[model samples]
Target: MKWASDSITAGQITLLRVLFGFLPVLGYALARRALSRHHARHLHHYFAMSLLATSVFYYAFAAGTALLPSGIAGALSGAIPLFTFVCALAFLRSEPVTLLRFLGVLIGFGGVLLIARPWETTHGVDPTGVLFMLLGAASVGASFVYARKFISPLGIAPAALTTYQIGLALLTLMVVTDLDGMTTLADDTRALVGVVIGLGILGTGVAYILYYFIVETLGAVTASSATYIPPVVALAIGWLLVGEPLQLRDGIAVLLILSGVAVLRVTPRSGAAVSPTPRWGPR
Candidate 1:
C-alpha cells in the first residue's frame, strides 16, 4: 500500500487512483451477488453517484499527499465518526444522540488530537487535501444514513447493492482512465496487479459488503462507529508488515478510541425509534 504512497510518476498515481476509486463499487457487486438472488435496485443509481464523489475525494487525497503530511492525513480521517454523528443529527433525525454519544465523540476527537499532534507539523498539511478528505467522510456518512432510511426498507440484498455500487464505479473508472496509459502495467506488473486486486476487491468490494451488513443490522449512526476500527488495523499492519515502531502513544490513543466506541455502543437506547430488522434478500 505504501507503494501507492511511493508512486513517482503521474501515470502510476493515476492508475492507483482509478483502481482504488473503483474498489468499493466492485466490492458492492461481489457482496450483492454472494448474498442474494434479487436484481439490483434503483437505489444503486444514487449509490453510484456517491461512489463517484467518494472516488474524487480519495484520488485527490492520494494525488495531494505530497502537499500534506501523513500524520495529519490520518488525524483528519479520525474525525469521520464525529462527522457521521453530526450528519446523523442534521439529516437522519432517527438516530438518537444522547449525552453518552456526545461524550464519546469528544473523547474520540481528543484521541485524534493526541495521535496527530498536528502542532508538530513543520511544513503543515495541505488545507485543501484535508478539506477533501473531510468532505469524503461526510459524504460516506450521508450514504450510510440514506442506506438506513431508504435502501434497507426495500429489503434489497446487500450483495446486490454491493454489485451495483462496484460495477458502476468500475464503469466510471474505465471511462475516466486512458487505456493507452495502462501500458505502465507492464513495467511493474506484479506490484500494480497487487494494488489493483487487493484494493479493488478486498479493500473496496468486501469492505463495503461487510459495512452494508453491519449498517443493516446496527443502524447507520451506530454502525458508523466502525470507523474507529481502521486506524488500529492500520497501526498493526504498519508494525507487522513494515516494522514501523509502535509508540506508546498509539496504544493509548487506541484505548481511548475503543473505549469511546464502547461507551456509545452499550449506552441505553435514547427513546429513538429503531428501524425494522432487514429480511436479507428479496421479498
Candidate 2:
C-alpha cells in the first residue's frame, strides 16, 4: 500500500525485495526436516511448489502495484477470504459451503468495500492494478487451499515448507531482477536497512511463519480468514506512524469483516473427510 502511495527509494525497495525474497526460506528450513520425516515426499514437494508460486505471485502483485492505485490494490486484497472460501468449496472436500460461510464471505467483501472507500476516491484509480491485485489474491487463495489439502494432511513442518518456498522465491528473483536496479542500494543506507528489517524479518519471515502455522493447524479456510487483519493493521499503522486520520468507514469495515469472520468461526466444522493423497488434495 505504501509503495503504491509514494515512490520508494531504491534502497527501500531492495530491502523489501531481499526480505520478501529470503525470509520464507528460513522459516521452511526450520520445519522441513521434521515435516519430511512425518509426511510423504510428494506432499513436501506440493508445499514447496505452492509456496514458490505464492511468493512469485506476491512479487508480481507488488511490482504491479507500483503502477496502480492504492485504493484498488487494497480492495483487491480484501477479496482474498472470499476467493479462499470458493477455492475450498470447489477443491477441498474438508471444507464445505454452509450458509454461515456464505454470510461470512458477504460480510468480508462488504468490509473491503468500506475500507477501500472506492466511492470516495477520485475516478483516476487504475483498473488494471485492481485486476492484478485480485489475480494475486486468487493465487494466494489457491495456495491456501493446496496447503490445507496437501501440506496439512502430510503434517510437514510449516517452518520447513516456508524455508523452501522463500529460498525458491529468492532464487527466482535473483535470476530475474535487473542488476542495474540494485545500484541504488549503495546510495541510501537508511532506506536499505529499513526495507531489510521491516519487510524481510517482520513481513516475510515472521509473518509467513505465523501464516503457515495457522494454515497447518486451522485448515485453509479458517487460516485464510486472517486476511481481514492486515487492512486493519495497515490502517492502524498509518494512523499511528504517519498521522493519517482514521475514518468512520474504516471502523465500519473492520466491524463487518470481523463479524463475518466470527460467524464463520462459530459455524461447525464440515463433516466431510479428506483423503491424504495428493490427487485427492485441495487445489
**For candidate 1, lDDT tens digit of each residue in 198-279?**
6555666567667667777777767776776666666676577657566687667666766665565554655343332332
Q: Mark the regions of model 2 whose C-alpha exceeds 4 Å error after superposition.
A: 1-53, 64-78, 114-125, 185-190, 243-246, 268-283
Q: Which stretches of candidate 1 lie over 4 Å from their true place?
A: 8-49, 52-57, 60-78, 123-133, 176-182, 243-247, 268-283
Look at candidate 2 and tell me the lDDT of residue 45: 64
Query: Could you give candidate 2's per-residue lDDT for residues 1-283 as a string of tens digits?
Result: 3432244532235335555646555645654543354434464564455443445456546754555433334434656767777788899776656777788778877876665456756645455565566677777877887767666665555576666566555655556555555545546665455456666667677766676677765677667777766656655665676565666766676678666656665545553332212232221
The CA lDDT at 129 in model 2 is 60
Candidate 1, residue 261: the lDDT equals 54
Best by TM-score: 2
Task: Please report, as a residue range, the 10-residue window in candidate 1 with the lowest summed lDDT.
Answer: 274-283
Model 2 C-alpha lDDT versus the unseen true structure: 0.59
